[model samples]
Target: MNSLLILALILFGFTSFYFGKSRIKKVTEKGDLRPKALPHFYGYYQALWCALPAFLIIAIWTVFEPIILKNLIENKIQISSLNEISQDELNLIYSQIISFSQGNFSGQVTKGIEAGAITYKNLLSISQGAKVSLFFCTIIAASLFAFRQINKNVHAREGVEKTLTIILFLSSVAAILTTIGIIFSLLFETIQFFTKINPLDFFFGLGWSPQKAFISDPTNLTPQEAKDLKEAFGAVPLFAGTAFIAFIAMCVAVPIGLYSGIYLAEYATSKQRKWGKPIIEILAGVPTVVYGFFAALTVGPFFRVIGDSIGLEVSSESALAAGLVMGVMIIPFVSSLSDDVINAVPQSLREGSYAMGATKSETIKKVIFPAALPGIVGSILLAVSRAIGETMIVVMAAGLAANLTINPLEATTTITTQIVMILVGDQEFTSAKTQSAFALGLTLFVLTLILNFIALRIVKKYREKYD
Candidate 1:
């Protein structure tokens, strides 16, 4: 019924647009004075008025409907009950009522439940009918008001532009507010986590075993227990693993991606570029989970076999495998952006370099590369961020053991992987072990922010130098 109402409203909006346009056209034809705005502007003006208020009413009704239904059910149940019902019990009874109403309940039905279900059904039907009437009344009233306002003197274009500006501003505000909300949520949880564990221990301590912090009584820990708990949440290993994996990924990505970008931008023929660039960029569209499976099932085992042949011990789930796969995944980001940036370098620079008796290689080395440095650096940093934040490949290819080692052949875990491990399954959110995930998240967020700040500074420096 709601879907039907929405479809009807959309049709009505379209009809109102055409009607308003034709009405305005008729008004202009009858009068000597011309309209201040275009006919389509009046159409837009009418469409907005005819639909916006009706849509607002529907939105408000949809939001309040569940609350209204729940309140009515609660009141009905309360009146029928003999004893005082607790909130949990009432919630449970409401669940049962919902199940019974939906024909999913298998247990014996109580009189109160049967009565509640019948009342619910009747009220829902009545509410649906009322909503339909209200929606039509709103549309009719709004449409009439809009039609009456269509005149030669109406500044419909100005009104539509102002309305659109306001909507765009509100959308920007919503996006900003959402980001602020996420940051605050992370900060609040991280603060809660820090209250339970020492900040120094969490940030700088070598060990990382959050499961060991699950004590019998978290609130009242003895000195020994407190020491154990302090040592349990150490994040140094996670940080090391993240940096090591990201470093390895950069090692694999930078040379290949940069060279590929340079080749495509500076050397490739049109035919080679058209085919080659898209083929390379296809890597970016490949899903991360697909990369994860490739790393886990193919790359990891291949590395293990190579290691065995060489008389070296390589873990089947090794950081090297994850990093190599991650590097391939982010290659397109670096290569595509670098190619664009390189191509954007001025033709004047290359011509001047040639005029100075510089060879093509010299022109490229000293002129184009320097000019495109900022964007190239930006692309590389963006790829580094992707590598750091990646979870799936690390989870599948690299084992979830926070071993604080620099060995790429050994199994290691990143901050993201540990956070996933900490939060997965039914978790006690209030526990120090679970809240540790937030702390890791906050730390990772800060590190990424710092990396971005550095990248910005570098870009600014080089951009100023070039510009």
Candidate 2:
């Protein structure tokens, strides 16, 4: 019923929008008066009037309906009961009533419960009817009010713009508040984790094994047990693996992506540009999990085969395979951004360089490259962030062993992978093992924040020089 009402409101809004547009258009056509705004603005005003009030009514109804129903059910339960019930028991009874109403109750139903369910069902029907009636009345009343105000002097455009601006502002505020909420949540959890585990050991420890810490009680630990706990979550291996994989990824991505960008922006014919750009961008649309599967099933085994034939040691799940696949996945980010940045370089600079007897290569190398350097660097930093945050490819191809090694042929794990591993199953959030995920998360957040700050600083510094 709710869904149908929403659909009806949408259809009503669209109909009102077009009707308002046509009415204004006809009024002006008959020389009734000069319109103060475009027909579309009047249409927008009508649509907003019709839909916004109805949606607001729906929102209020949706929030209060459940509470009101529950309260009514509670009253029914109280009346039907012979003895006073505790809040917990009342809540349990309410849940059972709801379950029975929904045909999910498995236990024997008492007379009180049966009475409560009937009351709940009847109340729900009444509430739904009231909601639909209220929603339509709002739409009709608001639409009539807006239509009455549509005149020669009506500032429909300004009204619509003001409404949209307020909406955009609210959306931005919501986003900012959400981000603050996430940061504070992570911060609180991290503080809890640090209370159990030493910050120095967590940050600078050489080993990474949360399993050892999980076996013992985090609340009360012996001196030796505490020492073991400290040593267990070294985090150095995870950090090393993350950096190693990202470094390998960047090494492959930078040269290939930058060159592709250069070719696409400068050297490609118009037809080639049209065809090639989309084809390259198609890589970005490919799911990362698909890349992960390719890495694990295809690239990893191929590398092992090559390694075997050459008699070099290679793990089946190696950082090389993950890194290589991740690099391929990241190519479109670099290529597309770098292409845009390079193309944004002034044509006059190229012309001037050529007039001064510089070749195309020399002009690009000296003039275009220097001018576009800031944006290119920003793109690479963005790609670096993308590579660091990647989990699936690393998880599938790089293996979950937190081996603190740089050899690409060896299996290793990243910070993200370890975070996943730590949080995957039934976890005791109070234990140091579970809390360690929060710690890792906080550390990763800090790292990403630092990278963004550096990228912004670099962009600001060089952008001033070039712009």
Task: Check candidate 1 and list the clashing pairs.
Answer: none
TM-score of 2: 0.88
Candidate 1: lDDT of 271? 100
lDDT of 1: 0.90
- Residue 47: error of model 2 in Å? 0.5
> Highest lDDT, which number?
1
State the lDDT of candidate 2 residue by residue for 201-288, as single tens digits.
9889998888888545567878888778888989989999999999999999999999999999999999999999999999999998
lDDT score for candidate 2 against the true structure: 0.90
**How does each model score on lDDT?**
0.90, 0.90
Report the lDDT of model 2 for residue 145. 88
Model 1 agreement with the true structure over 1-467: per-residue lDDT tens digits: 77898899899999989998888989988886689899999999999898988888898999999899988889878887788888878888888888999999999899878888888899999998899899999999988888888964588999889989998998999999998998998899999988888899999999998888877676898988988998898899999999999999998899899999999998999999999999999999999999999999999999999999999999999999999999998889999999999999989888989999999889888889888999999999999989999999999999998899988899999999998999999998888898899989888889999999999898787763544
Candidate 2: which stretches are off by over 4 Å? 1-5, 27-31, 60-127, 151-153, 215-219, 425-428, 463-467
How many clashes show up in model 1?
Answer: 0
| Cα RMSD to the true fold for all candidates | 2.7, 3.3
